[model samples]
Structure formats: C-alpha cells, structure tokens
Target chain A: MALPITSKKAIREWKLYIFVLPSLLMVGTFAYFPAASAAYYSFFEWAGGDAKQLIGIENFRRAFSDQVLLDSFATVSVLIVFNLFKMIPSILLAVLIHRLRSDRWQYVYRVLLVVPMIVPGLVTLFIWKFFLDPNLGVLNGVLEFTGAKSVLVSLDHFFGWGVFFANVPIGWLSQPQLILPSLFLWGFPWIGAVGVLIFLAGLQSIGQDVYEAAELDGVGPFKKFLYIELPLILTQVRLSLVLLVIGTVGGYGLQLQLLNEYGGPDGRGMVPGLWMYNRAFYAGEFGYACAIGMILFVFILALTFVNNRYVRIDK
Target chain B: MSACPVSAASPAPRSNARRDWAKHAIILFFILIELFPLYMMFQVSFKDTTTFIRQPWLPTNPLNWHWENWTFALRLILPYIANTVLVAVTGTVCSLVFAIFGAYFFARYRMPFSRILWAAFLVLMLMPSVVNITPLFILLKSLKLVNTLWALIFVGIAAGQVFTIFVLRNFLEDLPRDLFEAAEMDGASHLQQVVNIVIPMSGSIIGTLGILAFLNMWNDFLLPLIVLRDKELFTLGVGLIYLDGEYVKQWGQIMAAYFVASIPLIVLFLFTMRLFVRGLSVGAIKG
Candidate 1:
C-alpha cells in the first residue's frame, strides 16, 4: 500500500467521481443514452427487432412529405395562435393580482391559484373534455340558462345569411372545424397560475422608485403599462413565452387526450409530438419516430435560441 | 429597503378609489375563471345522475351527499394508488440520494471536467422528454423492465435526478462552506461530513425536492401508460385512463375518479405549499 503514495488531495478529488457517477449513470441511461440512441436509430430502420436496415435519411425525407406531418404543422400553427391568445389573459390577471391592496388577499389568491396544480394536468384535461361534451356540457347549459345561445343563434342568422357558418350545438372536441377554437375554449380564460405568480414575482421586484418616478411624470395607467411596466416585466414575458413554446410544442397532453388514441375527425387534432408518439410505439416505426423526435428537438431548440437572440424583451 | 416603500407599492394610487375597485373586480373575475373548472369537478361529484345532467352549475341536493361515488371511485383506484405510492416513494428516495451526493460534490469540489460535465447535464435537462421516449421505450423493453412498478420507479428516478440535482446544487452552493471546511480540518471524512453536517442542514430542501419528485411520479401519465399494460400493474394515472375508457364523458364518475387520484397530492400540497411555491417561483426566476 505504501508503494504507491497518492496525495490526500488527489484521493479527495477522485472520490468525487463516485458521487458524480450515479447521476451520470441515471441521466446517461434515460436522458443521454436515449438521446444518442434516438440520433443513431434515426439512421436505421427497425420495427421492435434486432435486425435494422440502413434507411439513410429516408425517414426524414418521408416525414416532410407525410400528410400527417403537414396537417400537424397546420394544427400547431393554430395552437400557436391560441397560445398567444392565452398569454394575454395570463398577463392581465398577473397585473390585476399584483395590484391588490392587501397582502393577505394577495396571499390567498396566490394559494388559490396554485391549488389547481395539485390536480394532475391530464385529469384537468379530462374534466375539460367533459365540459366540452356537446350534449351534456355545462357550457352549453350556461349558454341556455343565460340565453347566450339564442343571442348567438340570432347573431349567426343575421351575420351568416346561411352562407358559410351557423350557430349549431357543436361537439367542440369532435368537430374537425371547431377543434382549434374549442381546445381554446376548453382551457378558456386560461389564467395560468404559474404564469400569474411568476409575473407577480416580476411585478413585485420592480423598484418602487421606478413607479414613483413614473407617477411623478403623471403617466396614465395605460401609458405607464406601455412604457414602464411593460419594459420592466418583459423578462417575465420572455420567460413565459419560452415556457409556452416548450409546453405547446413538446407537450403531448392536449393532443393525447382530446384525440384519445386517434387524431380527431380527419386528424384535425393531431400535433407533432402526438404524431411522433403514435409513430413510435403504436406504429412500431422506431427509426421514423426517432427521426421525428430529433426533428422536434432541433426545431424547439432553434426556436428557443432564435427567441432568445431576436425576440428578447430583456437583455 | 424598509417595509412598504411609499405610494409605489400598489399599482394604482390611493386617491384613485374607482381604479382600485376596478382592479379588485378584475382580480375576482380571473380568480373565478381559474377556479371554475375545479369547482365544476367537485360540485359534479356530489350531484346525482339526474342533478349532474340537469343542473351541473347549480347546487346539488345537499342531504343526499352521494357517498357511493366516493366509495366507488376510491375502491376502483385503491390498488392503483398503492402502486403509485410504491413507485413515488421509491423513485423520490433514489432521486434525492443521487442528487444529494452529486450536488454536494458539484457544489463543494473543484474537479477536472466539472464545467463540461455540468454543461452537458444542463443541455440534457433542456432537451424535451419526448425526444428520449422512443429510444427509452426500446431500452426498457430490451432490459425486460417494462410494465413493472420498478420500471416506472426507475424511469422516475432517472428523469427526476436532473431537476433535483440542479435545485440541490444551487441550494448547496448558497450555503456557507465554513462548516464543511471546519469539519475537514477536524479530520472528518467526506462521508462523515455529509452525514453529520450536510444532512442536518438540508431538511427543508430535502423535503421540497422529495415532495416535488413524489408529485411528479404520482402525476405521471404518459410514461406509465406506455410502460404498463396490465391493469393490475398500472399506476393511478394509467388506471384512471382505463376508468375513463370504461365511462367516456361520465362527468360525475370521472370527477370522482379524478378527486380520488388528486387527494394525496392535495394533502401533500396543503402541508408543503410554502416550499412548493417558493421552489416554483425561485426556479422560474433563477432559470
């Protein structure tokens, strides 16, 4: 043992690798190994077997031409549109809550907002699925009770003249045309609790002196928001934007539920991630799925990077 | 920064009483919107079939107090809950252990390849979960680990370590290093220091990370759905889906099932809400 004398420092540092190894191993197997394996598998064709044929970018070629992929892109654009729609309410609510007179009320609202997080997200979607049920939905009931349905019917009759659209008892999730807007309605008034709280944090962090300075200038609320508050909380907006991009693009929750094993009428509800999932496990096109995964990864990564560079609210 | 930084605190001036009322009203409206879906779920669970169908938005017959829905929902999902508990507990423990060790070293030590490795992990953390799903499914199948609670637990542990490690590393870095150095000067071994000093001070974060991990595993749907096919083997997430499959769009029953699945997390949230909110806000701000 004395023959090879290692310094205590060397031993101290070397032992650190032991601590590092378990994490690396876990992450390697699940995160890196799969990522690497996905990249590797994208080059080969396999259907749940050892025998893999070299496809040589055939999957990528097909993916571009695939009708499902094209349709998904279209649907994703719609999703993106609604996503932007969703952010406005979220930001407005954040502002509203942040302006509360009482800290106790603010605390109550904060807790109330986050209480929903305890419910599984998928379960929430399922609950909304019920709410979107054409026949027995509360929304339709509310429309009936409040006579909004009749108002809508008359408005549709006046506006459309039976040319393009009409008021109908719509199956929000099931209808091909209504899918996008219906999905929006399902998570309607989407005051994202996390978004609100994060914006509240950003709002709270704004220097009081900045506000006082703005007040001294006698700026109206709208002008103040446009000039001062907007600039200040732009960082939160950016963060929320990035998060939305990730959640919408990467998240399979909505598509997986609303579509419920298959894409909606005429594949209207299909998004890219769900399409990738279906291709992978259900279709057994491992190579194709991996290619899809890689494409999604690169797309999101590029989008995020571009946003960070060009669309930044804060440096 | 003294307490209440003058008129700058609230959004509107005190003199603008009308504006204050408007702001309060808007806040209430948004809160109602946020809570509406959840309210629908809870109120529906109490409604009888007819009442649920007719007056979902209205109050239920309070005297009736549909105990059957709770009983049915709880009974159906009890095994699933038990399975979830096993997975969540096992996964959370393993994740916390691995993260603690990794974070301690990453926080305290100056090691070769640390920067590169840390960067690699950071990049990996950012990579979307779906990107890894296909290959991971294959990997799991090949390892003959699919459809087991252990497999679910394994995946949870593996997936959760990234966040747990990131959070714990940041937390540990913020703590003063003097105590550890003192222990080292007293001829304390790394293990001894970790056991005595690190563990003693890390109760809150450990709790925070543990709850977060447990919540993640508990609420996970896609992974369990893909992995487990056997109804008995399924976790709550997958089980609830199968329940939904049986009763498509049955609001009361569906709501009941959801409430049952949600109870554990609700109780957990109740106890650890401060830590949970702080973790979320801090994570967002810092990231």
Candidate 2:
C-alpha cells in the first residue's frame, strides 16, 4: 500500500527536523567540520595564525622521510601486538566471571577488577613506576627475597637466553629495548575490568536457548563457545578491536601519562599521537603534525572499516 | 582425571571443598593483583618524600601518615574537580535532552530523512575524535571559547550525543506499538505521550547513558587540554598531567595527589556499577 503524503505529514516532518536541529548543528560545527578541515590542513603548510603557505605534498613527503615518524609507527605496531596479548586474557577472564553462578562472588570480582579502571591513569602510572623502581620497588623486593643477586638487572643479561638459569640484573623502563614491555606490563592489569564489562554484556545478549540447544546436541562447553558464543559476540569484539586500534594508533593521553610526556627512555615509547603533539606544540611544526595526523586518521579509518566488514560477515 | 557422571543431587563434599578453595583462591588472587597498586598508593601517600625514596615498598617506621597531603592536594584539585563536574554534568544533561527528543522522533515518527540521519550518525560513530581535534581547537578559538569550561562542555556534548541517540533510538523503536496507539486513543499529544510514557519507561537506559557520559567526560584529557588553558579551569585528567609536569621529581607528592584525585570516580563507579553493567548489555543488544 502507498503511504499518504499530506500537509499534516509535511508539518510533522518539519517539526521533527526542527527538534533534531540543535544536535545536528553541534555535531556539524564541532565534529564534522573540524574533521573536514583536518583533512584539508594536511595538504597545506599553516602555523597557528593566518600566516599560511601552500606546500602541496611536501608535508607528506617530510612525514614519510622523518625518522621520528617512522619510529612512532613502529612503536604503535608493537603496542598493538602487546594490546592483543592483554585482550585475550581479558576476554577469557570475563567469560569465566560470566559462568560463575554465585551473584555475590560475581559482583565482588566485578568491583575488584574495575577498581583499577576507576583509578586515575596518572595515579596508576605513579604507583606502577614506584613499584617497578629499580632501587626501592616492591617488585625488586620480591626478587631479592627470592634469592636474586641484584634487584636492578642489566637489560642485556635480562633479555639474554641464559638469564632464566642465572640471576641477571635488568632495568625495565630505563633500558630502551625493554621500555615497551614495561609499558605493556603497567597497562595490562587495567584491561580486565573494561573487557570483562564489555564481554559480559555480549554474553548476556547471546540468548540462553541457543546455548541450551547446543547442550542438547551433546556439545561440550568448548565447542559451544566456538560455534555459538564466538559468532554472536563478534560485534562486541569488533567494537573493542576498533577502539584498541584507534587508541594504539592515536597513542595520545594514555602514553603521555604513562611515560610522563617525555616518552619512554630514549623515546622508545613515542607513539604517533604524542609525536604529533610534540611536533605541533613542543617543536611548532604545525604542518608536519597535521600531515602525520592525517595519515594516522586514514590508518584508523581503514582498520575500522575492516572491523565493520568482519563483524557484518560474522553476524 | 576420571570422568564421573554427576547426579541431580549435590556433589561430593571433597569436590565441594576443592571447588570452594579454587573459587576463594581465584578471587583473592585477582583482588590482590588489582588492588595492590591502589593500596600501595595509599601507603606511600602517607609517607614523606624521604620515607618514600628510602623504602618505597614498605610502610615508613615512624608512620608519618601525612594527613596534610590530602588537604594540600584537595586545595589544588577542588577547582579542577568543580570544572570537571560542571563540564561532565552540563554536557550529559545537554546531550540527554537532545538525544531523548531526537531518539523519540526517530522511533515513533516516520520522517522523510530519518534513515539518512541515522546513517550519518553511524558514520560519525566511526570517526575518531583525534581526527577532529585540530579543527575543533581552531573552531573553539574562533568562537572565543578557548580557556573556558563551556568550550569543553559544548565540545563534549556534541561529540558524545550521537552514540546516545543511536542507542536510545534503537531502544525506543523496539517498544510495542500498541502502547503508543493506546496513548493516542486517550487523546495524548506527542509531548504528553513522551513525557508520560517514554521518559518513565527509559529510566534504566537513561541512567546507564548518563553514567557512561559522566565517566567519559570525567576521564577525558584531550578536549579539556585543547580548550581550557587556565589551570583553574582544568579537569582532573588534564590537571593530573599538569601536576605531573610541574612538580618535577616529587613522586611522593604527585602520587598523593593522584590518590586523592581518584576517590570520587572510584566511589561513583562502585555505587553505579550494577546499573552501568545493565546499561551496557541493553545498549549493546539494541545497537
């Protein structure tokens, strides 16, 4: 049947548009317009003020050749790998929590895990920094109690193969090579709280009847999870993956907090986001920062698109 | 391991004992790991710089317990806390009002451009905030809102409203049409129906979105960093960053500040965790 399009309908439509106008205007002015400008700014060379010059593709060319930019990209790649290592355990822990029958225990676990997330990032960083402090850290205290020769192990001996059989002193964050791993260790404990929340939500959305049906078919817990739960929760997984990728690529506030804005020792923890900030604000390389940001944005967009596609297929 | 078929009755006492131990151990392990740093922060916050440097792990022998640190940190942090609360609450209220109306329209009224608007929202969700940061900075400057808390609030409201609207619309759209029709037969105006029916029914979802928004704004660093230049107008996140930079190597003092800064958020999270979890599950399913 054809729908009627009378004057009343037109009037109602106008009212609806008017109602949504404020939100639309806000998004357009603050979000969409700036996004468009960010893309445009990438193509030109402009500082803070009206003083501008058009240097077409030169900014991009400089970005490509910049050693710091390349290092930042390498740093983000390593962060992504570490993030996956964190995410897997987080999901499993969330599943285990969901399976627990006791509501009191579940609630206790939830609150305990989430306590880390609620703690301000700087506080967590400070605590971990102290905990991992070479001379007086609790970690070293534990190490010494376990009969280690030196609390602060040298990086070479620590990373070397024979360290397992011998006491080898290592500087976790002070050493350039070990900085990424140290940062990961500091960051990983907080993931379980957020991941568990997201995964628990995903778990509840997977209807019980589907699980019951799988059970009736003599499917074990492992097989049921593989065949049913995994596919159903792909959307949540995709959402989290996209967030993680964007976060790792952006490497903005979190890394700055963890590394105290100088990046890790020897700039080993310089992610693209901080590099952009350093260039634009610290070094006043506005054009170069914009170019790097544009590239990073494109990378994140592509990753998000791929994630959406995978999510759709899984659904 | 032997595979034993379990009856509908209770399990063996030995197995129950083992299971109880496992559960307790698991819970204790995670709780200790998660809360250890927080506990350590508390302990260190009480000690002076000398004590902290001397023995970072253990409590100070003298047990200084510098209650003055809290006062100092509070004095420094109160204005920032006020600014943060103002930004978060105002932004959340603004977004909620806009989203409730927009979502209701999308759910009930068949408009010509509804689908297009929805599609636009979906795309906007994928656009990272960093993509807009530079442009937003310029825009806020042009509006003469830089160095102001309002700039942070407005930008946050704008950036955050889309997701809330999407979630709210999905939820309201799934409401049974019969209820709306029943309300219509009772001579209810659109406004009346929304006020009398939709708002009341959406309590849980709204609370969830509000908590989420509040948490996001409270923890946000970038927007406040770009917009608010005055130290007095800084949010906690940005304030902590500034504090870290300005204090030099006073790690103990900084950690003390960090601990005090986290208390409000931690309290808020604990109080609303159940609702927060429920909201996530509902919003996820609907989305």
Candidate 3:
C-alpha cells in the first residue's frame, strides 16, 4: 500500500526525500566510502601513509602464496568446528527451558541465563585470560587440587607430549601445542545466553496440539526431540550457524588480546582477521592487509551462501 | 505450560511433581557451572594479591576486604567509563533518530529508485567491515576526526545504521496505518506525524534497539583501538587492555577494573532485562 512518490499528488511533496538524506549521507561517507576505498587500495602499494604506487594484482598474488595467511585460515577452520560442537549445549538448554511446565519458572530460568551476559564480552575475555595464566590461574589451581594435573602428567608421559610435565605449570596460552585447547576452553559451559533465547523463541511458536499429537503416538522424550523440537527450531539453528561462521572468520579480538599479535608460540593462534590487523598496523603493509580482508570477505560470503542454500528448512 | 496431557490427566501427581524437581535440578546444575567464573571474579575482586595467592579458592574474609582495590580501580577507569557513556549515548541517540526517519521513508512511500536505495542498505548488511577498517581510519583522519571521541561516535552511528533501519522499517510497516492517516488529516507535518504517532506507538521497540546499540558501542574495542592514539580518549575496552598489559600484574586491581567497567551495563540491564531479551529475540527472528 505504499504510495509512489512519482504520483502527481506525492510529487509535490518532495520534502519527503529529506527523511532518507541523513542515512544516505552518513552511510555513503563512512561505510560505502571506506569499502570502496578498500577495494581500490587493495591493488596499490601504499604503506597506510602518503606513499603509493599502482601495484596491479601484486598484492593478491602475494596473498595467494602467503603461507602465514593460509595457516591462519586453517586455525580459524578448527575454531569454527569447535564452535559448531559448542552450539549443542545452548540447544539442549533451550529445549529444556521450553519444555518446562510452569511459565513462571521458565521466565526465572531465562533471566538467570541472561545474568552472566551483563558483563561485557571484553571483560569475559580478560577473565578467561586470567584463568588461563599458568602459574597463578584458577584453572591450574583446580587441576592440581582435583588431581587432574597428575592424570595429565601420566598421560603426557605415555603420549610423550612434552607440553605437560611434572611439577611444572602448563603454559596454556604460551605453549604452541596448548594454544588451540586454551581457546576452546574459553567461556566454559558455552551456554550462549542469547543463542538459547533465540532457540527458545523458535520453540515457543510450536502449538500445544502438536505436542499432544506426538504424545498420543507414544513418542518418548528423546524421540519427541528428534521428531518435533529439533525440526521446529532448525531455522534458528541455521541462523546461529551462519552467524557463528561469520563471527569466527572475522573475529580477532580474542587472539589479539589473549595471544600476542605474533600469535604466540608457533603462530597457532593466528586468525585471518588478526593477520590482516598485523599486516596493516605492525608491518605497514596496508595494501596486503586489504587483500587479506578481501579474501576473508569472499570466504565468509561463500560460507554464508552455502549455509543458506544447504542448511535451510522453511518452518 | 504444556505438561504432557497423559501425565496431567493421570492420577500420579506426586511423581509429576518429583519430575519437575528433577528438571529444576538439572537447570540449576548448568546455571551453577555457568556462574562459576563470574562468582570467582567477584570473590577475587575484594582480595589483595597475597590473599589471592594464599587462598585462591576460598571467599575473601569480611574482616580483611581490600576496599583499596575498588577505589584504585575507580580512580583509574572512571575517566574511561565517562568517555564511553558520552560516546555510547550520543551515538545511539543519533543513530536511532536517523534510523527512525529513514525507516519511515522506506515504510511510508515507494518512490522511484526507493527500492534500489533500500537494496543498497541490505547489501551493506552483508558487507563485512574488516576490509574497511584501514580505509575508515584514513577517512576519519582526512576529516581530522581521528584520536577524538567524535571519531568513535560518528563511526558508531554509521556502523549501526543498517541494522537499526532494517528492524525499524519492519516494525513501522506493521503499525496501524490509520494512525498515520489520521495524523495527516489533522494537518500534522511528517516530522510531527513521526513525533506524535510513530514515537509513541513504537516506544518499546525503540527502547530495545537503543539498548542493543548502546551495548555494542560500550563493548566496542577494535574501532576505538584503531582510531584513537591517546590514553585520554580510551574507552573501557581499550583502557582495560592497556591495564592488563602493565608489567606488574595486579590481579586484584585488574579484576576490580573489569567489575568497574561492567557496573554501568549491569545497572542498565537490571532495569531493561525484558526489553533487552525481546530485542535480541526480535533480531534473531528477523536478521
């Protein structure tokens, strides 16, 4: 029912154009301009300052042969896989909350689920960094107190893993071998509060009649989940998957903060985004950084496309 | 409240109650595990370094609470917190204002090329900002805005536009058109119509969007890190990172700083918990 502004009566009301002008101007100047500039500068030999030259495909060519960049992508791929597994806890918690018989309890549980999120994500990252400190961390303290350290030592002896030794604190973030494990250990329980609520929102739309019908068919709890709950929430699951992929690929905050810009030890913690950051800021290779960014964009775009095309189920 | 019909209709109320307890127990177990880290943070915030080292697991004794840690952290991070509030509030308000106007334009009229304009915004949503950071820094520097809080505010407003407009346009479209029509009949200008009709009608949604945008700006680190070069301009995220990088690690003071950085958000979330959750779910469903 939108009235076309080209209509005779609406044409005179040209002032209506004023509504969108601010948005267009702001986005054009900040968002679009920078993006267009990135594409342009990717082909240059600029060092992020005044000096520049037309490098023509040279930056992209170097990116193609860049082992460090490729290895960073590999590290991200492993993290993405771990994140995919981490989604299970959130889904299970959502299903549990959705199945609660009392609405009051459901609200209480939901509020409690959101409580931990009040702390900004940056704060949580730092707290985890504190916990992962080898000598003075709660993680090592708990391991030693619970005798898990001794078990890990024996296993290290059996497996000849030099990372874990007796009477020595395991350098979780510092050691090359344990970098990925430390990253995975972050945000333990990983019951992403927002993720659970999204899945719960999806679950709430399921009618009571559906549950009754399933019960009549003698569908047990596990079978009910397989047949009904999971299917109903597949849309939300797909959405989370797409976002997780995008975030994991582009996110470098954790690595930049927890590990050094050099990516610690054998560069095991290096992610593509961090590599781009290091290139531009540390190495003064703005052109190469832009190329890396383009590579990340294409990679994320393709992953999102595949997710939408394959994992989709209309609810 | 969809207790299985079989269980509800049957005569086994006691076991049903027992099963409810089991469910609650399972939920509480997960909740406790999730809350452990936060609990540890709060407990350790009140302990000095020596106390933390000696009794890492136990709670700080009431007689020996290190109030100095809190005071020291506040003295150090208070300026950062103030800067964040100024930037987040101004940025969120400006972004929401612009978004409301733009969403109204998109929702109310279909002009020539309006669809194309809307499509441009949609494309912006999919375009990653990673590539743009270096150029954005250059852009801001060219405008002589870098290293100032204005840079963060402007970029925050710009980065927030697409999502806000997208969500608001949907909400505005679903609004009862008759209200706007009546406002037009009353000889209200479009701006007046927005102030009288749209703002009142969509207060909750606007509030939700505002909180979400504010949260994003508050926790933002990357843009501020790249743009700002001065310690005086550091937001909480960057400020905390610098604090952490100091050679002599004071765990107590550092944890206290984390708590200080989070207090404002915690206070805000306490009051707007429902709206915040609703906003997130709306975003999830619509994004």
- Candidate 3 lDDT over A10-87, as tens digits, reads 677678789999988899999999888888899999887788999899999999899999899899999999999999
Task: Chain B TM-score per candidate, please.
Answer: 0.89, 0.88, 0.94
Task: Order the candidates by DockQ, highest first.
Answer: 3, 1, 2
Off by over 4 Å in 1: A1-8, A154-168, A312-315, B1-19, B247-250
lDDT value, residue A155 of candidate 3:
97
As a whole number from 0 to 100, the lDDT of residue A80 in candidate 2 is 89
Model 1: lDDT of residue A217: 82
Every model's TM-score: 0.92, 0.87, 0.97
Off by over 4 Å in 2: A1-8, A147-171, A204-235, A260-262, A310-315, B1-20, B58-64, B185-187, B247-252, B280-287
lDDT-best of 1 and 2? 1
Residue A133 alpha-carbon offset, candidate 3, angstroms:
1.1
As for lDDT, the candidate ahead, 2 or 3, is: 3
- Two-chain complex of model 3, DockQ on C-alpha atoms against the true structure: 0.63
Candidate with top TM-score is 3
**Candidate 3, Cα interface RMSD:** 2.0
For every model in order, the TM-score on chain A comes to: 0.90, 0.81, 0.96
